[model samples]
Target: MRIAIVDYGMGNLHSVTKAFEHVAGDDASIVLTDDPIEVAAADKVVFPGQGAMPDCMRHLEESGLKGAVLDAARQKPFLGICVGAQLLFDYSEEGDTPGLGVFAGEVVRFPKERMHDEAGHKLKVPHMGWNEMFIAREHPLWQGISQGERFYFVHSYHFKPSDDIAVIESAYPYRFAAAVAKDNIFAIQCHPEKSHNAGLQLLRNFVHWDGRP
Candidate 1:
């Protein structure tokens, strides 16, 4: 199988590519490419991103891979990470940018007033580091993973789907969608590649998933 890790000039491509390599081994071909044709031809796609939303959108279009990425997300077993997840929505509060509109939702930032924990300690804006995730719904990508699994996260904005497609939920003093699934697309706010064993298991499950929920 050919797996494309899209390089849109924004994500932590090397580490994500390496993690997929470790999990996929010799069973699938993992290619990190900026070429739209390569992304379109792949059997599955891993779309990862970091930094600002505007920048991610800019690079995606500027790199000329937006169409291919959208096609892959709709047609194959596609995985989106971090800012990659946010971009799946129709719009984002960040820079007032628009996205691929594959999913109906708006990406919003964590409320600054609610950033404080129960003890009144102010949490960071990025909401960096590890946090436990509640499995709100079942999916093939979540196979073998238990509830409350800690996943590494580094983001300020989160996806709020218009429907009940959120499969994973977490909180930074407030509940929000940590991951969402629809048909062949599965996207997460956390960086599974950096989540250790539990993360590896998720990626492993993705490698074998037939895009069925």
Candidate 2:
């Protein structure tokens, strides 16, 4: 299989590429490119990104790969990480930026005012570090992974899908969609590349998934 990692200029492409390389082995050919044609031709697509939403959207547009990314998402197995995942939504409150609108929802910031845990300890805005995820629904991506597996996260905003059925919830102090899955698309807020064993396993599953739910 051929796998393409969309390089729209706003992501830590190295780590994501390396992780896929480690897991994919000889089973697939991986390419990281900003070219839309290359992205659209791939059998699978890994959309990984960091930084702010507005900048990500701007770079995606500037790179001329926006339509390509959307096309790949619709045509094949697509895995979106971090901001890449956030960009699939309708809009973001982070700078009031509009997103790709692949899914009907908005990305909202973690409440700055209610930034406290149950113990009354101050919680940070960027919900960094390792956190456990509660798998809201079963799908091909969760293969061989158990519920409550921990994944590394580093983002201030969270995706709130309009359809709750698509949500794979997680928590900092409260619940939010840690992952979302629709037909042919699976997205996550955590960095599977940085999540060690569980993360690598997730990537491996993606490599083998047939783009089904």
Candidate 3:
């Protein structure tokens, strides 16, 4: 499949490309681009990012990728990582700025207050390192991942999707949506590229997904 990795001058473009390469084999073609035409024509789209939400949104608007991404989400399968995922929502408290408004609800920060007692330590912001994810129900994107699988996550803000069934939740201080899917659109808070086997499999599934929503 021809997967277009959207480069709005803010994505973790190279690594994600490599991850696709690993899963999709040599025949898989991956390209980093900001061209809306190329992006819209792709079989699949990936929005990868590591930065503040407002700045990322501004770059999207400036690069004219905003419309292309939204249009692609409407037409085909799309995946967003970290800040890219957050942008798919209506708004984020991260910067009090608006998002692409593709999905309803807001992105909020991890509570500064800790909840420690008998279990262990309280979860903190920037839910870094390896964390376990429980696959919520059944989504084609997570077909092979079993219970208690760990994925790499590095983020402070989180997306609380309005669609409950679409959310695949993982833990931190509390359970937050680790990944989300709505019809043709799919998004992940963690970096699949950095998650080893489970993550690669997730990317592979997206590549092979028939865009059935």
Candidate 4:
């Protein structure tokens, strides 16, 4: 099996590649490439990104991999991380940018008024650090991962799916979609590569998943 990690020039590529390498080992060929053909040909595709939405969208289109990404996402087991996850939705409040529309949702910034916790402490914009992932629906990726397990997150915007595809939820001060799964597509707003063991387990499950759920 081969896993292609999409390198759109805006992703946290090296670390993501390393995490997949550690998880898949010799079981799958893990490659980090910007080639659209390689991405389209892989058994599964991992789309990871960082930075602003406008830049990510612009780079993806300019790199000539947008079509390949859309096609792969539609046809194979696809995992999107961080900004990659945000791009799967219809639109984003960040930079007034549009996404790939892989799912019916919009990425919105955490309201300034709601950025404070119950104790009235001000929470940061990019919700960095570890946060619990509360499973809302079951999926293959959630296997062996305990409910409420903390995952590393670093994002200012969050996805709000209009569909019922959300499988996990997290909160800054209020609940929001932490992850969403639909058919062969699974995406998370957190950085699994930085989350340690639970994150690695999720990657392991993805490497072996047959795109069933």
Candidate 5:
């Protein structure tokens, strides 16, 4: 099997590539490339990104991989991480940018004004560190992962799908879409590559998944 990690020049590409290597080992052909043809030829596609939405969109557009990504999301077993997840939505509040629109949703900021916990303690905007993920829907990707597993996260914006059923909610102070799955596409706000065992398990699941909904 072949797996391609989209290299849009915005994310920690090496770390993600290494994590996939650890899981797939020598059984799968894993490559990190910006070439649309390489992405289109893969069995699975992983789109990972970090940084602002505007910059991510810009790089995706300029790198000439945008159509390839959309096609992969529609045709293959696709996994999107962090800003990659946000970019799947219709639009984003960040820089008022638009996304790939693979799903009907909008990405919004974590409300700087209300960045406080229940006890009124100041909460960080990035929402860094490990956070609990409450699985909202059953999917093959969540095969071995528990319902309330914690995953590493580092983001200021979160996706809000118009269809509530598409969301796997997580709480910072309030609930937000921590992950989303529909058809052949599965996306998460967390950095699974950096989340240790659980993360690796998810990657393994993706490798074995047959792109079924």
Candidate 6:
């Protein structure tokens, strides 16, 4: 498979590409690209983000790859990680910055009003490290996921899709969208590449997914 890792000047493109290489092996070729033409032509695209919402979107727009990405998500399988996943939403409270509008709803910080779990201790921001995943719904995107599978996570903000994402549903002290798939657009709030074995399986699942709705 030929996966294009978007080079928008603000993403963790290399790490993401290396992950794909590890998973797909020699058959897979990962291309880091800023050229809209290359991105639009790839079989799959991985949108990675290591920064804030506004800057990422700005780079996408300035790079002239926004339209291509939108087009790809409409018909091709596209995976969004971290802020990349949040960008799939209509907007984000992070910067009141407009998003790509791929999916309905807004991305926002975990509300302070949220109640803490068991011990009543508040969960901190950027829910880093490994966390369990709850499959909210059944889909090929999660072909091998069972209930409460663990995956790596990192971020101060999270995605809350308008509808149920494909998994069963997992939560931190608070609930948020961990993964989502709508037609050709598939996204995960967690970083599968950094999630270890479970994550590798997730990547394999995505590559094998039929991209069905």
Best by lDDT: 4
| TM-scores, one per candidate | 0.98, 0.97, 0.94, 0.98, 0.96, 0.93
> Which ranges in model 6 have alpha carbons more than 4 Å from their true place?
166-168
Give per-residue lDDT, candidate 5, residue 50: 93
lDDT of each: 0.92, 0.91, 0.86, 0.94, 0.91, 0.79
**Root mean square deviation (Cα) for candidate 2:** 0.9
lDDT of 1: 0.92
| Per-residue lDDT of candidate 1, residues 1-213 (tens digit) | 999999999989999999999999988999999999999889999999999999999999999999999889888999999999899999999999999999998999888787899999999988899999998998989988889989999988889899889999998988999999999999999999999999999899888888877
Question: Which regions in candidate 5 have their CA more than 4 angstroms from the true location?
Answer: 165-167
The candidate that achieves the highest TM-score relative to the unseen native structure: 4
Report the lDDT tens digits of candidate 5 across residue range 1-213.
899999999999999999999999878989999999999999999999999999999999999999999999988999999999899999999999989998898999988787888889999888989988887778888889988888998988898899754547789888888889888889988998999999999998998998886
lDDT of 3 by residue, 1-213 (tens): 689999999967889988997888865588788899999889899988889998999999999988999998888888888899999999999889899888998888887876342487776567789988887767889889888899999888888877674557887767888888888888889999999999999999988888764
Which residue pairs clash within candidate 2? none
Q: In the order shown, what is each candidate's alpha-carbon RMSD? A: 0.8, 0.9, 1.5, 0.7, 1.1, 1.6
Candidate 4 local lDDT, 1-213, one digit each (tens): 999999989977999999999999889999999999999889999999999999999999999999999999999999999999999999999999989999998999988887888888998887889999999999999899999999999988999999999999998889999999999999999999999999999999999999989
User: What stretches of model 4 exceed 4 Å from their correct place?
Assistant: none
* lDDT tens per residue, model 6, 114-198: 7477788877776778777876767776776667888887787877777755453457786667888888777888888887777
For model 3, the superposed segments whose C-alpha errors exceed 4 Å read 115-122
Local accuracy of candidate 2 as per-residue lDDT tens digits, 46-142: 9999999999999999999998998888889999999999999999999999999998999999987878889999998899999998878888888
